[model samples]
Target chain A: MSAVTAHGVIAPILVPLLTGTLLVLLRGSATPLRRTLSMLGVQLLLGVSLWLLLQVADGEILVYRLGNWAAPHGIVLVADRLAAGMVLLTSVLALFAMMHAIQGSDRRGRQFHVLFQFLLMGLNGAFLTGDLFNLFVFFEILLIASYGLLLHGGGAARSRAGLHYVVINLVGSSLFLFAVGTLYGVLGTLNMADLSQRVAALGPEDIGLVRAAALLLFLVFALKAALAPLHLWLPGAYSAAGPAAVALFAIMTKVGAYSILRVYSLIFGADAGPLAGLVDPWMLVLGLITLVVGTLGALASQRLALLVSHLVVVSAGSILTAFGLGGEAALSAGLYYTFQSTLVVAALFMLTENVARTRGAFGDELRAGPMLPAANLLGGLFLVLALAVAGLPPLSGFIGKVLILKASVGAPAAMPWIMAIVLITGLLTLIALARAGSTLFFKTETHARTASLPNVAKLVPVAALAGISLLFVVFASPIHGYAQAAAAQLVDPGGYLEAVLGAGATDNDADADTDTEPAKMAEVAGPRRTTVHSPPDQIMPAH
Target chain B: MEALIALVIGLLAGCGIYLLLRARTFPVVLGITLLSYAVNLFLFVMGRLSIGVPAIIEPGRSAYADPLPQALVLTAIVIGFGMTAFVVVLALRARADLGNDHVDGREP
Candidate 1:
């Protein structure tokens, strides 16, 4: 409740936005200066995000109201354990992505530093925003920056995949707006806390419409998360992105998963009157399918980049399945899995780039080539990342999967399916990655020309990320405890609701105004109708 | 009036989906544009389509159209505009580089 802590919530967002703007203005400046600035910016973001995470680590929900507006009427940024953790994860990922890009990828296009910073801004904002409309706005910002990054290298494959990525997201954005409109029209509010209160008070008649809106919103997030049937756009898009961009893009799918967890828990949680458990069945089934399909895709992919992309899909499936199982333990394990997968996949993307670069003429196509320079170092990094991603023993992936499986035991019906799909998928991922590793690194043949060693700068980031996953395994206890606390809060959103809407605001009062109105009220009242009304008492200040 | 608005939204979305399914990039982009238009209108209509209500809140006014959706629509419009511009340029580049406009970037 201190002023500095309140202001600290916004710092993660402001640092990146200001830095990106500065970088854009300094576009004419030399690359070294821009690189230095971006490095400083991401480092600052990491520091601030860690601070926020520490502040919220004790299960505190920090709500920052913009422009001194009260919770309902003005924009609010709520930082709880989940949001802060996500910001921390993003900043960490962004730092390494920045480092990798600085080494070489930045040279491929203009404003690489600026776009990367803006992408970070979008991500932090999306994680922090408490208003649904603002979430849409932030999503657009992220997608636009992603579009720029997707085509940074300027090749046929990038442009083609970027086209599909852009068009599909544009449609998704449209759908997002439609869903927002429907929710607003029905509930008469956009604030998460207010929506939760209102939604719980909704009568049976309004349940159907609300459910439809919720599902529509779910579809948008699912598309972003790249779940099955909606996942066609992901492999092409992620594989097409440059190494650095793909490393950062790894977190983008988590944004989708985060939204689903946040919105579903807030609005349609177990307490939700008629719409409780609405998404559970669908998410469970579809998530399993996504796992099956993604694993198959990974198995079938010949290119290392596509293989990593499919792994991303597999991670999504696992997280969604965990989410679908529905409990504090399951959700907490899912969160841990999310963090582990994001870091490992990001490292894999960077490693794949290095591996490809070291194989002259083969270019990460999973084919044998000249023995790469520094083969031992690159191979070691690749093996660690590959094992981590495939959920092998001694890595964080195994621990995360074990936690998820242990949690799924409570849901007997889903337990068997979740176990079967996850274990099977893990096995397939192991096979695919091992095959890729042997072909690309082990089965190497000599040629007249030797592939060059990867740059120290590029290799450092990959090593750092991989090292962190190892660190995660060593420090699994505390992180698991944190995830458990975060999941507990998610299940009981009272802390979040109270923090945003103020204490003493209960659903009983909300129910008084819960009489369902027909959609034709606009027509009945006519366009010109005017009447006197008094605004509700402003319970909270923006600043 | 509500029915009419719904019909329009449905029609636009349907056409947009149809165009989106086309093999060529131009039509797909066009499809996205149409879908965005439909979405913008859908957002606008969420404010309940009042014509004579002041856009700004008055001291004593209780019966005003919901203004929040207008703000949302405006934001959506600007975003859609920028996105359309980017996609158009991207499609043009794809055509020039790949020598075709197929969404998959190659001929059947």
Candidate 2:
């Protein structure tokens, strides 16, 4: 199975899944206590993740159920390295951001820490859950908390943006429901492992059903990930949502990417027979185009916040391309890039907030000019992240991109022209970042900029992230090893496949004996043959 | 049968998107509501559209619709209700917060 137990697997998701109710009930009592409890919760989550990562580092997979029911009959929580890694990453970003939240100068929500904590709980849970239904539930939990936080300070701009953000995600959630619902209808199973085994058995005549379901699911995720063409709502929505929201969102968007990575590579890989000609090739093409369009959008954006948001789109698209094209090296590279891009974009957005404060609120949009003089620290951090984003040399972003390019070079399934497009896109990205950097930091200003007030909470994390970016070259080996292990775990479906079919801890050896993955997984895992379904109002999927 | 439902839903979804592209708040809300329904229907059709068979299992019957989708739809319906309520309330707030109810928050 995966590197850990279902007990460990369910811990990350369950702790946060139900924590929101308590957080809401406890809201607005005392600022100090709320802040302390929230931070404690986040740190405790981090500790759980650290333990999970440590336990699973040697390649153990864990599966857990909410109640006592097994797959098809009950909800399952699956934790592979990839899913666990995301949990760790998301927890790190959210914890740091929450710390930044408690440093007060601006008017945050009255119970900002409470809402923020619930939001983190939701986020961590979403990343770790093994089931599709609960994925959506956690998604709502996160989104609902986001709603309160986004409109927490209650500004005209934030409220307006929150409306768009809330509505759009709601649309996304609806789409997710629709896709999952349809998949269940066709497969008769909701457990991901069960589906992975059974979905392949749906005969050739039913291929059309598979394609439609895959597309629906992909679309919902794409909208969340802000893959190009479908990414219409992101820039304005993210830019106006407040500093904490935008920074935290950089990692959140990757959950969509992570979902695609988990679903397609692991669960959907079982059913790739029908998807052979259609999904894979287009995914590569779409990914490349998304990368290009996203970078171009970032370049086109005049405002700093919007540019950072669009950059998230660009990086997500990069991960999408890498994940879709299944080369050993490419997948590893993509995972590295995904991690790098999330961290970089977060740092960049934090810088954007600082830049905005110094320049005053944009009357229309962020203008290109040397708004602040001698802003060397700010400029250097901005430039480093920009170059890293553009895939410049000696940086982690560049290394990751090079690995992706090297992986794509020989694969003939994609056109030589597709690689050309990605390359051209990379070059264009460098040019765009250069121009924006010059405009914002390097160029001379006609208008005198307002001085920025110091906030150690914000500055420490931003500086720490920049320092991490600088150490990309030095830290290459360890990072690569982690990425490699994570990728290998992903590509080889054995750990996960065995986990579901294998009996309890006592009989785990019974499964290992029948090591033939394909032959062992070919069974039909139809729904639990029960006469009664949980009645309409009480029904919940086994996410 | 699935294609027909998907097609009808697509048409309505297109209309909703058209309305969403407008500058007025009320039309955008209407569009979102309609589009949501279309999405729900389209997703249901993706399950291959079995007619009148209960997804729940029965004794001595091998054929049944998928219950997972039904469960998901139930949640979606509730979440959708929450969404509509949020949007409608936001609309009212937007009306109250801003002098006019324009889809674009800014008048200029």
Candidate 3:
């Protein structure tokens, strides 16, 4: 509640950011010192994330206006329990990945640390920002750092994949910019909370072209989210990137999901957008379809990292699909599963790195040796994660699915086809993981005297990811409860808007001023709130 | 008027898609650019274009064109530029390093 709390909220994005910048500035110093600084940055972000999570649990939403300006005019950063939870999760995994990247490398560790920090900064910033424009800015921050991290090994394979990765993301970012501009043209505002306020008052009567605009905007997001038909770029991009990079990027899709979460709940309000009743429902269906396609890709692929990372894509689709189902609990499960899958995929990526690095020279493709039936620790972690990915029983993943299924099934609001796909995809996912495990990890080493691979630190990140999944299972209820509250607040956006913008401040010209409207109309789109403005017949006048 | 604009967009989209389906990376990139332009113009026209008035208004000026779509289209144009550059660089890199300009992955 103090100024310190606001500082805390903003620090999650800034801590790693400053750390990354500092590390980059100090690159090529003493190796031990560089390693220490890299570890320090990760540890620092983890601490900040923990504090932010606790603040959210106290039932307080933190909104930090950059330079103390108001919403609409100035960029706003927010941390509800939901945003904080993601920050906490991302920070933990990032720390592990940073450690793995540093320890695994034979070169100086500082540059790696810098990229990792900036990447984390992007993730945190994307989650925390309340402005649509700022989201694009954060996407750039993440991608710029990602470009460096992706090409870390600097070889034929990484370089080729790196080109594709940069291109795909640049294209995605362009789509994002276009969508934002279009939406801004319609709404006359860019702040998400304020946009929600204005958007409620907009319809085809006032803006006949909204239908097309909305669809286009959603298409932009869909591409970023890798929704089914738009997901063709993901497997190649994730697969081509190296393991540590892939593991970090595994959670990158969550930025897209979080934007969906923000937009669906805020600007579009729960009931609006081009897709209408079909939006969330169709998203759910798309999620299931993506799940099937991604898992099948995993099963069919020969590479270890590619197979595991595709599961990350499937799980992302599943999260969106759950949202499509439309109950409070179902949506909450979707949120929780996003955090859970981030961990599971991270673990799987780490394990892939270990196996690949050990089999180096031959690591370009995911080939196997002649013998098998051992390496319990690494293999067991992989099995558990694979099971988690498939939504098997007693795990947190299954809990998310069960909650979604129970909430969605027989619900007339959602398309029946979507529910069916979720069920079918669940089955297919299991088959996919089983085939992958049987093919790659179960086989023995081809060469007995391949010589020891460099650095044991490579194991830490994936292990951290797997460890977090186990923690997710153990702490399912609390996490689920937080997601539920976050979803509830999402459903009733008034409180959130007020917390960020302020109460009763919607009448002012928000674009002209920074300090007034946001603090006053902090909360927006009260639950099932409808502005009963008289509907117009093509409110948009003809040319 | 709306139908005409839509038709133009549809035609551009069709041509873009046809080019996109080609085997070469450069053609696909070109197709993407053409499609982006068509889409941008379509979005611009979607604000229900008014020939007589610009969106920006001065004091005491009469009603203007809807301002929102214009802003959106402008941003989209800049972003499209960014995408085109990225694709161009990627295509060049693919050709230089891999010795092939096709989008297909090299088999191990």
Candidate 4:
């Protein structure tokens, strides 16, 4: 790869940070101009992320050192197939969500465009970062932006929901710091690839503390992923957010799942001596519980938005369960499902807003509403999305679930529970969505009729999401192939380590070749050693 | 000294958790702040406590405190401050909008 192409990993983080900063500076500009700028920025991000995905599509792990600093010393960004694909998924969702926002909702809050861009920056940063501290920073970035977005409209319900969301995340953040501190204390390195090596070579006396830190880290991620007991803050927060914001929020939960897959498989995978497979059983049980709880919540929801939020939880659960199964096939299936669920849930959130608007005073409540002027079009879109979300036949959701089920059959111990819960959840989702659809479409009151037709512009984004979801089913083979490649890269950490910490960093000869360089260079420089810390010969070129 | 630092962290964390479990938003915000402080202290201690030890590298010095954890703690404190400020504002807004200071906006 060329040097320019090697710089692609940082582009995902830089593009958004620069753009969001520009938007903040231009906050006083005309609305149309600001909107155009925001849209253009997101379009550029989509192209950049897609190019990155193609770069890593063949399972090449690309590591970009910030400030040309080497790993385990300076921070780095690693873009393998998994990270690249996630950035692409996020950019795609952001494009549609931005399209939906420009329709009207962007006017509801101060710096809506600014917050949106920063949120993207944070999400991309989280996916691409290779250091544990940088991961925490990115998490805070995304959570802060999400806090602003959630309270965009500023209502009683939103404020209430936002309070819980903010508090819970703050606590989660504290726990994350605690875990990170413990890890650094034990391993003395925050770079993930370096941590992987240290974890494998850990002394027996320190294993217990390292294991504790690892599990604590998992707990923090589970909170972000909204897994079961940690998921109580999701439904209320998601349902109460503005429609455009909620649509974008769909990918936020997957950040948790992505972190789990990355940290566990890399640092604590089979190579971590006694700490190997420590999180596997906990992940499986918590994921299953999250699935059941989410389904039950969906069934009991009286509002369309709340039901969709529960479905988000269900998607998180399914993804985690697949990942917890621990194999290339299972990880690949989970990745595919992550893509499908994010797209479908975003579309559903936008559709919910349109449906509520068409009903006027009746809103999104499960009770009967007035006859909608665009009933046929809205109902058709809802039916398709609901089927997709419920994981029914002839949709991408079904393909994802089937792939996961097929992967699960290999694990005899957990296969029955996985199959049973997944199938039952699908059934319950179908019933809940069916009932929701009927109430919104067929049970309209005759006394009142909504005269204004739903805006075709708003429906454009919804239709686009639904269309891509359908395309996901049609193009399942290529997508799943890409996912398998990503999973393959994830399972083997040697390449990742070499890419980040330089070649031979994982082998026994690493110390002789590289680690002693600073000492040797210092001795050679003699009295000038203080100024000779990182001579040109010592700096590793960006790969 | 290590024992004192550990006690401080434990006591702060315990009080923070207690406050966090309260039903009101004000107390919860305070709890989050206290918890973040405890976390910051814990992170600082992770570098191994030292008195008058230089964090920066210099010539002829064989011993120095690990600078990485101090950097980590600095970042955490800045982030925690921003979050605490944001949450405090959010609590005020919730009270103003919902007409209550309850975490749920209404009494249980």
Interface RMSD in Å per candidate, to 1 decimal? 4.7, 4.9, 9.2, 7.4
lDDT of 4 by residue, A73-102 (tens): 789899999999999999999999999999
For model 1, residues A89-141, the per-residue Cα lDDT tens digits are 99999999988998888989888888888899999999999999999989988
The most accurate candidate by lDDT is 4
Model 1 error, position A85 (Å):
0.4
Error of 1 at A239 (Å): 1.1
Q: Write the per-residue lDDT of candidate 2 for residues A1-543, one digit (tens) a residue.
A: 443444676676555544545566776566676666666777777888877887777777776766756544677676667777777877777666766666652246565665666677677777767677778888887888777777766768776777778767776776677677666655555666656655544555556776787788888888877777878777877787667666788877787877777777766673345664345666677788788888778778877777777888788888888877775677788888887778778878777776666655442144554356446767777778888887888777888788787778758757476578767878887877777677766564566555555454676777777677767667877776777888897776767766654534213333322331322122213333221122333334322
Worst 10 residues of 1 chain B by lDDT: B55-64
- For candidate 2 chain A, which ten residues in a row score worst on lDDT? A516-525
Chain B TM-score, candidates in order: 0.94, 0.88, 0.88, 0.96
| Descending-TM-score candidate ranking | 1, 4, 2, 3
Candidate 3 Cα outliers beyond 4 Å, as residue runs: A106-110, A271-278, A360-374, A410-420, A441-456, A505-543, B1-90, B105-108
lDDT of each: 0.87, 0.69, 0.69, 0.89
True A-B contacts kept by model 1 = 0.54
Instruction: Please give the lDDT score for candidate 1.
Output: 0.87
Tens digit per residue, CA lDDT, model 3, A1-543 = 688986888898878878877877787577777678868877988998998888888668888878765554556898887788888888877767666666655262226667777888998998888888778778778877777777666556665676666655655654565566556545555678876766655544534544565556667677777888888777766765656666788778887787777777776765344434435655776877787888778778777777776787788788888776666777787888888877787777777767666555556255555332335555676688777877887666787777777767657656476567777877877886777666555655656435234344565566666666777789988888889888887777777777766755444444323322222221221111112111233122321
| Of candidates 2 and 1, the better by TM-score | 1
